[model samples]
Target chain A: MEGPKIYGELFGLPITQTLVNTWIIMAMILVVCAILTKNMQKRPGKAQVIAETIVTVMDGLVGQTMGKDKMKFAPWMLALIMFLAFANTSGIYGLRSPTADLNCTVGLALMTFFMTQFYGLKSKGLGGFLKGFLEPMPFLLPINIIGEFANPVSLSFRLFGNMLGGGIIMALLYSALAGLYFFPVLIPVPFHFYFDIFSGLLQSFIFTMLSMVFISGAMD
Target chain B: MEGLDFIKACSAIGAGIAMIAGVGPGIGQGFAAGKGAEAVGRQPEAQSDIVRTMLLGAAVAETTGIYGLIVALILLFANPFY
Candidate 1:
């Protein structure tokens, strides 16, 4: 509600709870990946089966959203989705979701935006990409530029807003119910399910899907 | 000079006003749900696909409402002026 608390400073940079949570998420992901891939077997074990299923699902998602030709983007998409899924659901673990912080969401959105522009330029030459802005009429260039700039802003705010809203509601609910001993224990479960689990996963999926659409749209 | 009470009052009003953005998403999602129901009624076999698409589009449509909630929360808990 009051934004992520700054715990301390490291060197010159301010360290916030969000940063710590992000690092934790990253470490967890790394450890899981390491454990899953530590041993290779011709006849797959349960861990290998789980890992393969995840890979196949991600591959299918990328292929469906960005086209089969863009399967190269599957790894990045998988990483983004996995990070977002964990970040958005970190509230269940009593950690402030990094996505709730404007800085985090903006950074993620900027990555998508830059990727969109970079791939656009790569697929279409600079001249062609520039020419895209002048389509139908050259006078529409300013409008097109504004629309292009709005992408990252809306993308960031959409995610930040949803995550922060959930955090605020959960905080307020806990405070309001604290007076009732049993209510505090029992009432927040459904709210937690909807906000932290359902909305978190759905938002992560939406963000990944939108990123795919934007990048692929640029390339195509 | 305005006292702390005035600031609190204004923050409360601001939070209330910010929540007005929810109206747009409420109507939009309801419209989507109705259309989805119509489609499913017409082709019951494709209900799963229709529901999936409807949910995705509704989630996108929810952006504005979430934006409103953010503004309201900021006003209530993170009032910059305070």
Candidate 2:
């Protein structure tokens, strides 16, 4: 429904609940990463094993999706998935998912869009990248440009729309069931499972996978 | 004013109309599911992979429906015109 509430302002900028929640997610991620990597041993500890497994899984995923040559992008993809997974599922903790905000989703999608363009330019020289729009026929250049621009729009709206829809439905359900004492307790659990947990993780995976595809497609 | 009531009534109708976009994803995902079933039937061994890919594609197909829901929700709860 409405955007996140504005808690206050910092200097000239308005600080919203979304921003606060995002900062919390970031700090949590930072603390976990630090703790997980604090001790490196010849014989891996449980934490190290978990950390290594995550890394290798992410590495394998990126390799499979974007090819081994694009493995350098694994760290960025990993961070994107981690942030999105947490942000999308924050509703479980009774916090509004930051991904429900257009600004957050758009910002993340723009990062992916920029990465695609940057890698494209690097792989193909500036002239070559520019010339790509003219491929097969120069008449198709405008269509190609529009297609490229559509990527970020669709990407941002896809994530934002899903999370916001979930939030709105959950809110409406709670209010609708507020009159029934037991309905409120019994009804929302399955809805929460489908909307918050399943859709949240699925959307996060889709977003990251699409980012990899777009970036790799551009570079190739 | 009469104008204010008129706008509110129109906004409600607009929200209802926006939800018609759900038709696209419904049809698309149904077709995807049918195809997924066919694939799984053809290769029973690859059921897991087929189902996984189908779910992924179905989620993407759901974007337009979600967009429609968003517009309807915004119109009802966060009308910018208001």
Q: How accurate is chain B of model 1, given as a TM-score from 0 to 1?
A: 0.94
Q: After superposition, how far is residue A10 of candidate 1 from its true place, in Å?
A: 1.6
Clashing pairs in 1: none
Tens digits of per-residue lDDT, candidate 1, A1-220, equal 6768899999999999999999999998999999998787999998998999999999998998899999999999999999999999998998899999999999999999999999999999999999989987999989999988988888899999989888888988988887774645667899999999999999998899999999998896
- lDDT by residue for model 2 over A89-147, one digit each (tens)? 99898889999999999999999999999999999999999999998799999999999
Q: Could you give the TM-score of chain B for each candidate, in order?
A: 0.94, 0.95
What does fnat come to for each candidate?
0.94, 0.94
Instruction: Choose the strongest candidate by lDDT.
Output: 2
Chain A TM-score per candidate?
0.96, 0.95
Q: Model 1 chain A, poorest ten-residue lDDT window? A: A178-187
- Superposed Cα deviation of residue A61, candidate 2 (Å): 1.0
* Model 2 misplaced stretches (Cα beyond 4 Å): none
Query: Candidate 2 — what's its lDDT?
Result: 0.93
